[model samples]
Target chain A: MKSNNSFRYFLIFAGAGIYQWAFWHETPGLNISIFTAFIVPTLLFLYPESVKKVPFWLVLTGLLSASLAIVVHASLFATIMYVISIILFVGFAHWSQTKSPVFAIPSSIANLVLTPYTFFAFKNYVATNNKKSSVFLKWVKLFVLPVVILIVFFTIFYNASDKFAEYSDKVLFPIQDFIYNLFGNITFASIFFFVHGILLITWILIRNKNTNLSDAEKNQTVNITRNKVRRKRHFQFLGLKREYLSAFILLVLINLLVLAANIVDIVFIWFGFEFKEGMNLKQFVHEGTYLLILSILLSMGILLYIFRKNQNFYSKGKILKVLSFAWIFQNLILAISVGVRNYHYMEYYGLAYKRVGVCIFLILVFFGLITFFIKIMQKKSSYFLLKFNSWAMYLLLIISSLFSWDTIITKYNIKHCKELDYEFLVHMSTKALPFVDINKLSTDLSYKNPWIINSNYNYDYFYVFSMRNYYVKQVFNFLYDWETDKFLSWSYYDKLAYQNFMSNPELVKSYKIYKDYRIKKNQIENGNKNSVQNRTPALHSDESR
Target chain B: METKIQFKTELLHYILMNPVRSEQSGRVVFSEQFAIILKIITS
Candidate 1:
């Protein structure tokens, strides 16, 4: 008994010690001081089953002072460490079924201050905006993004950090990194997931495929689906037992939503944008996360409505049905709209022109659809369905592979490249043109007496031209039919500008006029804009290798 | 009969007290001191 007692203490102490040592090496200065002070006390306080006898509040105050010693410069790491400690405490609380842990209040307050700072850092640095006004305002979408990212990264640590560092360093640096990564790209993927879940619930309705039943039977089926009950014998969370089946279904829906949203974003980005706000299905789904949070309020509303209408069976039933159906219907509408838009994109891009293959695919699909409908109507399916499904999946995989191969081949060839006629590129980004000698641009050119000027050292030609000014502005406008008076980075295509002028000698007259104007003024105001207007041919090929 | 009850209690306590051995695979598999203590009392 004594040996076991000693062993348990030894493991915790040893593990905690190793974690602390690793942290000391990784963290510098004030972080080290505060961590060193807090580690021993945290272990001591947390170790006891009951600190009520030993003045827990006084001990917490001491812990708080020590934690506060952690410097702001080390805020990123310290904040993360604090968050991890909070999470650990949460786990402890869960296990013990008590929230009265050592330094609970002080630690909570410290985290409330520190966590927001980490979020703000990400916003100011990564998100790159000047929109912040108050401390609270700074902790908006931008703040949430980073904190979420941090949580994800911490949750999934590599073997090197989790296993090796756990014993050697008592600090939670890996956890901090995890949090930063989570907030980094939550909007695009996270929102999609939320919407995808709602859509999936609706999709289950669409995919039900039990069409042969009479209206009463259909209604019965719908009722069965709607009033689906799940029973659980033993499992519990938050002191409440859940229906295991319902929980599982909800989890599945959540996972599907995440996957679908991610896929939508990926697919939309892969194809060029022709949408308002350049938002894909992924972004739309992200907007749905804001909607899902409304579920709590909606649930409350549903409960109240049920209480109010408990006497009227029809009203109560209708209210419940509407509450359940609303999410599904909204999700279905979103999915259908996005799917149509995707088809429209396919048509516009001349991908639909290659419809011979698609026609054959449609014929095969027609047969499959007929068979599926017939089976559902007759309530009859073959035993060989599993085998058939496997074969069909394999065939689909092959077809998909072939399609990808064709697309890849087509992607590389200049024959399929979108034509950017010379006039458009010349009008967009002359700043990217190599007409200005790199040597002269990089250094100030003093041809006349003693006037000195700063040289143009914008080496980021690719971003300034193709990505920002050229493709984003002019091309997007032409594609989407959206009018924006302001020109953006995508408008420029220097290659097109050069091609337009090169076809005829008459184009040089505009260049000559610009040259004469420059000679007379000795400087051109908005030279970049003017140069784009009277664009020259690109020095190299337009198609990027 | 007394010995059997004590043995059963010790077994129950051991099962509850010990950290599941399967989880602590590669790293040093230190025997759980707490479980051993609980076991001793029941024994």
Candidate 2:
């Protein structure tokens, strides 16, 4: 309380408590935009020394990502971007102070999580500069663990036995009442938010005074050095000339192989192959997916090997360089080939998480090959390749989050898919529920007729029908859960979905019917299972019908 | 004719091969029954 920076510390702590009370008291919103607003300013204003040393573009990008959270519809993607932005900015900021680049992310993350501990355990002199604070720490050290254990035991007993809970309530009611009156109805969730806020600010302020990872990457240079050849005891096989020849030959071979594969894909898959309804599409594109992955990995390996040293400096290196560029170009086509393969697969089978993941992976490969091209032209070291590709990955990840993939998969599959995997569609998110509702499907004639959509999959018609009912039940349950979760654990898309469901009269009517159907269906089926005589008649009559 | 087949198949198969709900809902029932028993015992 009496340190030189005691008031500043108090202000930081009070800011956390007030922020928790204001925007966070319930489930804390997990709203990264709001969080970023608090964090960026607090760190800048209070601990300018730490955040300001980062380059202008880096800081601007961090701020832009933080601000994007406010502009974009809140999603898991925005949240991840916000977190990674913070981590990168802080990590780089901390790493910059150490004069390093490539390994900043890991070390800075370590700093972010462990800062409060580091601050309290070693740097407590900044906080507890008074004699009374030492006494307080001693008291806390002796009592906190036992008090925590007691509280845990009490909670377990209270939950396990109603008698014990009632007895404890009777004894503790007056004290609880007194505490409630004194604190104006405090909750564990609120306390957690308050503590989290303090920890976040602590991370912003006192993070990684000692940089570990940046030091490791401090001397990481971009240029690949050419060492003068010193003959090592007749090991002529280890010569750079031989290495260049071998890499050139390998590239020439792979280039021809990949070009041939790409030609087949372009001719058949891109322009010629047609999707039939009953094809085993699950196996058709399955092997193609792995081939694309292996090709991409192999291309990277080829580039890394050929460009490992001064092979690019040889007299006949022009042809090798041509071969390398040609190889990268062919690999880019191979990436496009997978994109087409995925499209064909989705055309028949349907768009789901797997197909979308392939699309994203293709984008990553495209960036990687492009970076490889750059690495060859610039003679950039392996670390530059790592660094540039990671940046590309960061951008791609943020962009990918902009769309609600679940709803897109659902709507897209329903609109265009030749065959529907009913089980998987049933298991999809509530965001796509209305799109698949049987009543809605009937009204919306643009889509194929209900049977036609889910038909070609090799399952019993009855099984698919029951699945439709189950899907309806799922939607109803989701809306019910949304109603209860109005303010608690708020998500933008979920809330928007709730509003849309409530406003649509047809959807509401359908929900009610589905709910009623599930109850009746359960009762009738249970009764049939219990009655042996009835079961015999029902089976016989079903056959007769 | 297709609609009739679908309806008949749905009616029969739904009863015969409904998903095993009891495997999941059995846990829910046990917890609910436990709560009731606990209430009675405590009272």
Candidate 3:
């Protein structure tokens, strides 16, 4: 028993040390930090005797996803991957410790949402443990009193003696400088990671220590309570015949509405029929996509309410099932229409982060509709449907995080779209630099508004354009700076792109020429104030100059 | 023993429902000081 406690303490200490070392340094990349995060918790909290038992594959996959995130330069993709990794890390830890049913979304959410309270609880528990923690508490108390006295005495003595203060300054200033150098570079982000990592690891280690019942036993107890409730409350609020009739009427009305919307979408959007007057693509897409998702959710709620346990035991339940299936099918069609509307919008205006999100959301809704169908067919509870949908969403998010959408969006716009929005591309993060076709950009300047490109351009736009150029130049300069260490930036993908840009002299020359033209044009325009009213062709000729 | 158990349960309920008063002024209560109250109660 003593040896077991000693091992647990050792694991906690080791985990905390590793967390500080991995995350406290400057340029701590996503991969090593995520990997250590998972491994440390598993080492500290998961043992055979522990109630929660985490499978090894979940941890491995989390580490792999983190590595994938590190390799990609796109901030969105890396952020998603990092988020997924953290979720899996905490989820698996909670699952292992509680011996709860697998893929318990609520447990994972509770672990993350209640982290502060969990840390507090663990701290309280540790403080109460006399055998392992009392000695440390005693030492801390002993050390604190003397340090307080020493600081008070040192302040009084330093104020009293000028000569003593001058001599002490020589020693104290260097020590202060050393301490400043050591701790000054510690950023808020690094401190957050350090504190959060320790709290999470400690919380996981001690969370399961008090649990006496396995999940199966807990479920049995809940079932018994539910049975008691079931006997006391008669769920037959309405007669079977009336319930069936109401559900039938509701499903019929909803299905008709869904069908009408789908037909309109099929004609106007899917078949490329001309839209009604004043109905632009933006208005059509934005207005319908989100409302359609809500309708589908409401449809799910209706089905759940109508087909609840006692209500489904009617002789005409088969008719309700059929009607509900038809309603789900109609909702699926509505979801597809939403997807088409999004696609139309993307085609008109180029791809963006939100459009990609809508597409993913549409896919999830499609799966949810299917899950609703299965729930009806299998006579499964709403809880089962919710759990299934949550897992599906989790898996989809993880899969989506592996791809760099910025590159995909850039390449698609360049290769497939008719009009390229250069301003938008320029404002994008450094991740899209590798995919930007400079040659294509030079030729595609025709689509830009003439007034915006002329000598009297808006100051705000000019400022943004110049800032974009400045950022590109800074990236180029950073690549060849040679004085700073290479590993300081933390992004391997950004370095690789900059290195590639530097290696190709022709591309480098093209970029420099383009940048110089824009700068010179701006300077020439700013030099001539009267040139603004004339809309001079001379400023346009500056492109050639 | 039963009376002691009931007293403890009632005390827990009272502590949970009522706010903690500061030492300097009993009239000044803090609703967010549950952790401190919990520490005191457990000790």
Candidate 4:
């Protein structure tokens, strides 16, 4: 056991070394995949029992998510999925019982919540065992922890503030020099990571048996308890009969109200709706989506409240159950209506981030409604609903990361909508640069700007028009980065961007010439009013390229 | 047997003529994409 402790300490130290190597001064890309892959074996060596027992499905999930990072450089979704899966993969394997392998719910939560508090596990071990501390040990304890913490703070402060960095460096130059000599070669970024990694590994490896969550989770039954005999008349308030009556009445009223709303939608929005000139499709989709989401969430809360404990097992629960199912069914239709409205809006106005976000949100809501349906039927606790829904949510995030959404939005909008929403385009991800066919700037079906007629404008349309050179500059910069970025930062999206760019280099260049002429024409038209705008900022495309 | 392919010019005509005025200040200018859209409903 003592020898194993020594080995464990060595392993944690080494894990930190590997962590620093994998992540040093780099955004997530191939490095994330490499580090996660390394983690599996290192964890196995440190925790044989846990690592070996990680279920095949969870391990598969870890691999799949890690592959997304390697493939697309870990978008926010992919990085989250990869991180959570590995944590749960190890946590659930180590802490969960054989019967409750799905103890992933509690264990994953415990790993996050419990680990931070255990960062001093090694120090505690050293303290508890060393009753008569050696003089050297006393010296180490008094100085080592504070000095290590000081260095970490110093590194972070130095990086965060240049003013502080200049002064701190001069004062601490000799100490830093000594560290550099001792370490052979190192960077502040590396030092920061190495210190942090030690803490992270300690957090992961040290088990707090007293505070373990899975034990309690394992004992929780999904099904609520039912008493065969009724409680005494004095305790009738806690009885099912009263609760059942109240819930039944509430559900009936809500069901009727919701059905009326659904019917209106079914007849108009679903069956036959036309986009009229003055009608606000933007408001119809955007405002309606946010409002509907709140109501749908509230409906779930109401259902959960109504069917609590004994009310679920009510002998007369038949009507209430039917009503609950009916409400869920209606909300499902409501979700669909929101989706339809979004589709119509997108079909007319073209895709934007908010529109894409609504679609993702609707998918989650569908899962929620379905799970709520299951919960009532099975007489299950809220935990069951949360557990299954969380798993679905995790899987959905991974699935979403599979597509490059900004590029998709860019392509769809340009092709499908006549007047491109330059607001959407201007802020699109670098990958979307290649998809923005500059030739399509001429494809404005009306030839004249529509906003010209409305005249209730913010920035002048022609100003936006002449800013094509700016857009061209952005594309050239994007392509240049694609060419120059190291393989460590490369993604499948970058490869596609490169190919698309190479396919249309000449067409993209034409936008610059066209815009330059437009800008010159605009400046002459403005005559002395826009002299500042006339001074065309030297846009050298070749320099950008 | 002979097969003929025909294109409907109505969608193109709509695009050439009518452009929908945008609603909100921040949103995209509405365009002929409405007539251009081929919507198919599924249960």
Compare the candidates by TM-score and give the number of the best one: 4
Off by over 4 Å in 4: A1-3, A51-56, A59-63, A98-119, A123-190, A227-238, A439-485, A499-545, B1-43
Model 3 steric clash total: 3
Give the lDDT of residue A123 in candidate 1: 32
Q: Indicate whether candidate 2 or candidate 4 has the larger DockQ.
A: 2
Candidate 3, residues A1-545, lDDT tens digits: the string is 12234445555566665666554432324545454555654644453343334433444365466556665553555555565555555445444543223443345555555556655554443324346655655777889989999999999999999998999999999999888655554668767876777665554454432332235323532111112233444565666588888888888887788788888888877887554657677767777787888888888888888977666567667877888888888888888888888887787777877789898898898889888888778667665675567667666776776676666777787777787766566445555665664433322212343334453532313332232332343344334331132243356566666776767765455444333333333334344332222221211101110
- Give the alpha carbon lDDT tens digit for every residue of A80-104 in model 1: 3444343333223212222222223
lDDT per residue as tens, model 2, A1-545:
22334444565686675556445423223344455566666556544455555352464465465446424344444555666766666665444453332465677678767867854553442334454445545776999999999999999999999999999999999998877654654568667867887777666555555546755675777777776776568544556677877877788888888888888989998899986768777776778789778878977886887777667567668788888899889888888888888887777677777778788888899889888888888788888888777767776776675676667777888888766655566555565555664432221113222432355422334343345444444556566455433253456666676787778775565454433434544444354332211121100000000
All predictions: root-mean-square deviation over Cα?
Answer: 32.5, 12.2, 20.4, 15.1
Q: Would you list the rank order by lDDT, best first?
A: 4, 2, 3, 1
Off by over 4 Å in 3: A1-21, A24-45, A48-56, A97-197, A204-236, A274-279, A437-489, A504-545, B1-43
* Candidate whose lDDT is highest: 4
Error of 4 at A381 (Å): 2.6
| Chain A TM-score across all models, in listed order | 0.20, 0.68, 0.68, 0.71
TM-scores of the candidates are 0.19, 0.66, 0.64, 0.66
lDDT scores in order: 0.32, 0.60, 0.56, 0.62
- How does the DockQ of candidate 3 come out? 0.01
Q: Model 1, residue A326: what's the lDDT?
A: 39
